[model samples]
Target chain A: MNKIEVCFSPELIHLHELQGKIVVVVDIFRATTTMVAALANGIEEISTFADLEECRRMKSQGFLIGGERNGQTVSGFDLGNSPVAFIKNEYSGQKLAMTTTNGTLAISKSANADEILIGAFPNLSATIAYIQKHRKDVLIHCAGWKGRFNLEDSLYAGALVKSLESSHEADEDGALAMKSLFEKEGHQLKGYLGQASHAKRLQNHGIEADIDFCLTLDLYDIVGKVENEKVKAVIKP
Target chain B: MNKIEVCFSPELIHLHELQGKIVVVVDIFRATTTMVAALANGIEEISTFADLEECRRMKSQGFLIGGERNGQTVSGFDLGNSPVAFIKNEYSGQKLAMTTTNGTLAISKSANADEILIGAFPNLSATIAYIQKHRKDVLIHCAGWKGRFNLEDSLYAGALVKSLESSHEADEDGALAMKSLFEKEGHQLKGYLGQASHAKRLQNHGIEADIDFCLTLDLYDIVGKVENEKVKAVIKP
Candidate 1:
């Protein structure tokens, strides 16, 4: 069994030390939530960019510009960080150029990982299945707010760890902490997650429904993987 | 009221942005714990260094070399990273050069902060008193285990946030999370910290008693501050 470890923040990872591990990118606050919802509702592949200029450059190449800043849609972008914005049927089969506060930052940081998978409560099962088949050491990359630790990301990581407990070891403190936190509140994710800073922020901003929606587990089986600058739905061989 | 933020991992700090804040360095695993214990037991001063060579040079200057690596005392060092070792009455009035896994790293990282104070449970009240007097803005730096997040550090941060909740705004996600965690377990720090990876490791290594000792609040009233490369006792004036 391969030992999977969870890193609570991207800064915890030394890229060179992770040469062979399969990395899971998690931004539960909204990025991965937005991604899963976009794909589950029929959007095509999503291309990511570390910088807004790069994402803008790709929009002319048949990509729909989408992303957010401080939880709102960028003025000219096609979509924002809201999962609600991603659910309209108009986006079916169109490529998305997505940028987010914490999610894209983490993706950019994990550019050198052997493989990257998007893990969110919405797509938990598919993510687990993919990891089990790959049989590679996994690193759960929590896209913390800016360079700091965020609770939503860590809770999602805890959920993943709880699901994959048989196949992974808690190598780092983040991993162990997640496991313990999970044991303490796994049965009531939404209640525990209510304490999350982003969740409270979103709620205070009058987006309480989004938090409820984001906490829905295994709502979609869509598996998104980063390949050549875009995250595509992986068709399992 | 000023906003107080606590970051358990140095990686969580955006040092460039924290230029004018009053920062507290907490490394309960050994560094801050030893600092508080030493000062309380009468060590005259404690100097910290990131480089072993600098520490070695100081040791030759009649300073006691006190530090550890991988949980063991460094070979040839006069003392290791144990709070017990620092509390020994035999070491009263001595000068010490210390280096450890996380605490010194945090101090070095705070090179740009307006001022830095060491926060450990033993000196929690004194640290809070220093914060009250210097209330420009406070950032607690949790010296995590070698650039990785450790539960004990975060819990210690929570203890600090719980102490100053009435006078500060929890600004960022990391700070808010620390505050939430503190509110949840500040009273049972040892029990709360028992779930951390470092605590488990220390427990497995038969040092659980040290973990308990380190979590005890207000054992000493000394505030440790790093000035001129040495951690010296400071009064709240």
Candidate 2:
């Protein structure tokens, strides 16, 4: 059986051996959710940058720039880190250059992984399907809030672990804890995740809709794969 | 309300601000449990060293030396990391110099905190009462398996958060997650923690008794406080 593990925060990423693992990078509050939404709605590809200046630089090359810092949109960026913003297909066929406080940094830090997949509740099923197909050791890398553990991403990891339990064995206590967390609270995703610190942070910014939307499961039947630093949609077979 | 937070592992200690906080350093499988047991059973004071050599050298000074590496006793140490070994008061009235793979390292790293307390399930209520009496911001620093996240320590953290819930607010997602975990599995702690990676590690070495002893609640009514680099038992008022 393939092994599944969880790295609760990007700060703890160094402790994980990523060389031959398929890392499912999750930022459930918005970043990975937004990527899935953007790709599912016809955005050609999503390129993530850890630096706002680097993401903004792509605007001159016709890429739609999206950046957020501390849960707010960068002053001059075309979009904030919101999945709802990408749902209308308004930027269909465009390439997105995005940066966020946690998600993009996690993606960049996971460069050594054998394969990187963007994971969120919206794309959870597809992400599991992809992992099941590949049968590689999996690491769910949660882009926690500013290098601290967060609830939403870990819940997403738990959901994935539960789904993949038949074929994959949870490799450590982190995975077991998350799997148990999801089992207990998975049914009330919105209500449970709404209590998360990151949820409260976003709620304080008056984005309850984004939090609700981000917790919606299986909305997109596509997997987001990081290829050459760009996230592209992988439709289910 | 006072704040309660959990640092899931020593490796992630750098991300947490330890100053002015009371850190409850826990190694549920053995180290802290051993300390609590040793102090409760009449050991004079316990000094922790991260280096086995330093611990070994203390023997020449008439201190009882206990050391472990990777779940086994280090060669030539006076005792392995076992609470049972200390329970008989075999080394009563003697100072203990100890080193272990994770617990000692966690205590050493948490020296920046205002107050350092050794925590274990055996003293769960006492630890809670001590925290309530102090009413300071608390950080439950789990001495996870070699700087990685582990179940037993986090569960102990969760138990503290839950018991202190009325007076303390969870400071972040880590604390909140642990609180929920404890609430969900607190009653069945032995069965729940028996599945932990570290528990399995110890069980493989034929120390199932230690695992049971470590998970037992309220085995002693003492809080081990670190002062001048020594853990001296603080009896409950």
Candidate 3:
């Protein structure tokens, strides 16, 4: 059986062997969810930057700039980190550049993986189907809130592990712990994850709708593949 | 109310602020469990060394040296990382120097905390009592297997958080996740943790008895406090 492991945060990524694994990078509160939403809505591609200034620089190169810091849109950016903003397909056919506190950093740090996939609740089924077809060792990387563990991303990781249970073995304790968490509380995703620190942080900023949207399951049948520092929606096999 | 946070691994310790907190370092599958057992049963003091050679070198100074690597005792050490060896109090009044794959390194990394306490199931009540008396922000540092997240240690952390919930707030997602884990599976610890990777590793080495012993709750009323690199049993206030 193939193995399924979880790296709780980007900081803990080094402890996991990524050389031959399919790394599913997830930032459930918004970043990865937004990427999936944007891609599914017909955005040309999504380029991620770890720095807000770098992401803004992409605006001059004809990319729509989206940046957030501590749950708010950066001044002068065209969009914030919200999946709802991308769902209308208003920015359809646009090339987007985005930066966030945690998500982009997670994708950047997962450069060593054999394959990198952007993961979120919206693309959950697509992700599971893709992994099942590939049959490689899988590592779910949660972009925790600023390198600290968060509930939503880890819960999503658990959701993925639970979904892939038939083909993949929960390889490590982190994966097993998350699988249990999802099994127990996943049905009440919104109410349960609302108690999360990041969720509360976003709620304080009046973004409760974004949290609910991010928790929506299988909203898009899209698989995002990270290549050349950009995440592009790929056709599922 | 004071905050109770769980740091899932020693590698993630840097993300937490430890300056004014009471840090509980745990390695449930034997290291911290052994320390609690040794200290509770009248071993005078236990000094933890991260290096096996350094721990072995303490033998010349009248210290009983114990060391383990990958679930087995070092060939020349006086004891292995098993609590059962210390339960008889054979090393009463003798100081011990020990090393292990993950435990000692966790203790060493936690030096920045205001106070460090060795924690395990056997001393669970004692640790809870100590934290109640101190009423400080608590950080449960789980010494995961070789800097990776382990179920046993994280479960112990959850148990600590659950016990302290009346007096302390679950401060982070990690803490809340662990607290939920303990509440859900804490009652059947042995059976639940028996499926843990570390527990399976020890069982493979023919140490099933030690796994059972380590999972025993409140077997000791001793609180091992880290002071100047030596863990001395302290009279609970």
Model 2 interface CAPRI class: medium
Off by over 4 Å in 2: B70-72
lDDT of 2 by residue, B1-237 (tens): 999899888888999999999999999888899999999999989988878898899999999999877667889988888899988767778889988768878988999999999999888898889889997999999988867889999999999999999989985899988888888888899998888887887889999999889998897888899998899998831
The top-ranked prediction according to DockQ is 3
C-alpha RMSD of each candidate structure in angstroms? 3.5, 1.6, 1.7
Candidate 1's C-alpha runs over 4 A off are: A69-77, A132-135, A182-212, A235-237, B69-76, B129-136, B182-209, B235-237
**Mind sharing the TM-score for model 1?**
0.85
TM-score of 3: 0.97
Please compute DockQ, using alpha carbons, for every candidate against the native two-chain complex.
Answer: 0.40, 0.70, 0.75
The 0-to-1 C-alpha lDDT of every candidate, in the order given, reads 0.77, 0.89, 0.89
Off by over 4 Å in 3: none
Residue A83 in model 1: lDDT: 80
TM-score of each: 0.85, 0.97, 0.97
Task: Give the range where candidate 1 chain A is weakest over 10 consecutive residues by summed lDDT.
Answer: A9-18
Residue pairs with clashing backbones, model 2: none
Residue A216, model 3: Cα distance from true site in angstroms = 0.7
